[model samples]
Target: MAGQAEIPADVVALCDYERHAAERMPAPLRAYVDGAGADGLTAQANLAAWQAIRLQGRVLADLRGADTGLRLLGLDLPHPLILAPVAFHGLAHAEAEHATALGAAATGSLMVVSTQSGLPLEDIAARAQGPLWFQLYMQPERGDTLSLVRRAEAAGCRALVVSVDAPVNGLRNMEQRAGFRLPEGIRAVNLDGMRPPQIRSEPGRAATFLGLMDAAPRWEDIAWLKSQTRLPLLLKGIMSAHDAERAVAVGVDGVIVSNHGGRALDTLPATAEALPVVARQVAGRIPVLCDGGIRRGTDALKALALGASAVLVGRPQIHALAVGGAAGVAHMLTILRAELEVAMALTGRRDLAGIDETVLWGS
Candidate 1:
């Protein structure tokens, strides 16, 4: 709170956002947001992912009633922004997932509540004023996984965003360096009593990642999982066309081309670079959503022009929530929507459908 005198409480850009957040959080939590992740290359790459493409400006177009609204997977949004799932919200604010649910609803945006959410899924759902999706992290036990999915379904979640990227949390150097760990009181409340999976390690040898993944769900689990629920299933963390093809072949309703925001496997290509190719593979058979290093309306527009049905924004919203809770999150979306509108008008794009590769300079 020492810097509160200098940094403004409200943020319209990154500088103020970072300043206020630093004023409030302990050093370890800041590192959780800004550091770690495979020498930080993939995370750093995400920041610059949209730099290469430039939008083409058109002279004039019929701009009457210009809008940024979009429809995806049976949900209508006032704009193309979707809130990506980020966990451990209690670290940022006491309201945790409950505040985020309210914030998403306030902005008419959708939020994918994480399995690691600080509040119970039901509590968060009670606060949501708009559509909600639940992100799943396939519990070690199939029964536990099914139980959470059933809860989300009963709570009115529109979809299940199954995150496949992080079979385990990334090897976060900064988290280790800062000695960061979840506070004792804060935990994944939805999974309060579930059994963690068992792993067999060799004598004096650490259990390997491949070993843990082996204990985890595999590609073949899709069919059985689908049979257990009626909600639309979206496989997140997909980056390759081959995986997209496989997902479609097996009846996936959607795929998000994400590199886990560079928090999962390091050295993966930025979501910006991977999205176009993955979108091409889906060929509109299923909606393609993407997220990574997105900060402004221009970033979202660049992604849409590259063939994403919509874009996901995670880190920035968290920053806003850290600064001012639900209202702050709404303001961030408001600024983004305004920016998107200006970008659309300047580029002579009338609507979401009008965005295409042609808008990009080298496409």
Candidate 2:
């Protein structure tokens, strides 16, 4: 609420939240949140790519009764945006994922719980009032992955999102330079007590965590994963039209066009650039959601027009939680919702359905 008036008048206030968060968080945490692959070209491009798409406004339409609600994969969302899966929220705040889940659900938005979440999935689920989706990072073995899926199902998660882009961890030079690592006593709760795949690195090294990730999930593995969970399966980190088509063919419930927030690959195309092509490839057979570089309501509007059922916010919400806990996250979502509503009204698009390619001009 501190910057409410400014959000409608200027987009810079939305970004201010990130700056405030950086000041509030410790150096290591800030580094992890701000860092991207290699030179951060893809990270910078993610934000720039969205800015390049201009909106074409329609005038003189009756916008008296505008609505932002959308039905994504059978769930009715008040807006076409959801909180992206970010691991170890506890690193940001003491309340961690619970605070975020509560804030998102309170705003009628969805929350995607990461496999590496600091809090237990059930605890986060217990606080949610809106839809909850579990993000899966398949363990080194099939049994471990299946077990995690079953636990998520028991925790009342409505859908399963399998992140497939991180086959191998990306090079994060910032974390290394800052000498940052997951703090002691913050082990991923779901993975607690399990002997995670060992990182074959020098002892007491930052890269040790990378080896713990089993980044290999082949097409057959996807099939096996599908058979393991009854909940609808969504494939995240999809950037290619070919992979989008493959996801549809493999019977994925939906596909999220993402570049892993440019955290996985240094030179990958921004999510915005990849969305339209993937949307075309899917051709409405399935929903195509996108995430990465969505900082403002207009950025989200651009994504919707280009071909996304909904957009997901990663760093923005995390920064919010880091700065002001539940209140900050709530305020951030509230600001974004208000901006989206105003943008829709001003553009003469009264509803989510009214947003389409007609409103966007690509550079």
Candidate 3:
């Protein structure tokens, strides 16, 4: 790739694969994938947050074969791993979302296909053998958003994931410096034919939130969206317990504690810091999942011990998809799963049920 040395067969870590993929990608797209908020503090925190708690591994336990299987929103996954929906996979490779979907299928991992997918939802769904969840970014018009949902349902998506934190794009220093623009060939193809609802904004001397997110959905909107579809509904980007409670009250089936990979708001607490509080707030009323800074199995295990029912891997899968297409996605997950199983065995856990807060050294 780009005259770079091919990825070594023994290089199992995601970071290594990412390095290999980075060699192939153009600078602007690399910045888009790796760059974070204003100063990248939040992005750094998403990775560093896991350092606070250490694992208390047990020495004297029967560590035979261990399983990492998990169920989220009624979908049984081979592991507690889900590939997070990231936009514009075409940036990494030519095959784009189709390759990523195939990778998820190969690993028996649940995949959340983004609203800004490079491929049509139907094509992605057809390629994924494992469960597919459509991550929704509401169109300015309600009917258009519902139309997208109907399309997902028709394409056999198992659940609907509504991203709630972003009304407007985050201020990304990297993208700004890189002069990032959607290159001529890549686009969010699935958004074709959607129209925006007219937004009325008054002339103002001071800033206001009203016009900030023209298509931003509110509580009533979420409730109405829930009523429009029978598919299991999940809310992503929830950081506060108050929001978690409101979502549960609004009848959402699950919650994903995320900080938009620290790409949205620059200074938000890492997803690692938010999951516990939200999990406590939900109080097992609904399944709670998490994403961001999940590079290793220990990181994932910590999320489970903190309160997540499962975890989603974003950049790692992208790296895999970039290098090996669907097969690359499979290899990346296989490595991640192996690391997780090793962590489980050393910690005296034989299965996911055996994992809890006790495994955390701080506990």
Measured by lDDT, the strongest candidate is 3
Residue-level lDDT of model 3, residues 1-363, one tens digit each, is: 133224468567988888988887788878898998799999899999986669998988876776788777777788999999899988776778877877778778889999998888898888667789999998778888999999999999999999998777788889999998997867788888877545566676222255546557899999999999999999999999899999999999999999999898998999999999999999999999999999999999999998899999998887777777777887889888898988998899989898899999967
Error of 1 at 97 (Å): 1.3
TM-score of each: 0.95, 0.91, 0.94
- How many backbone clashes does every candidate have? 0, 0, 0
Candidate 2 local lDDT, 186-268, one digit each (tens): 97899876556656767667753556544367887888888777798999998988899899988889999989988888999
Alpha-carbon RMSD, candidate 3:
2.8
Q: TM-score of model 1 relative to the true fold?
A: 0.95
Instruction: Find the candidate with the highest TM-score and give its number.
Output: 1
Predictions in order: lDDT: 0.83, 0.84, 0.86
Tens-digit per-residue lDDT, 110-162, candidate 1: 89999989888998887677899999989878889999999999999999999
Pairs with steric clashes in candidate 1: none
Q: Model 3, residue 182: what's the lDDT?
A: 92
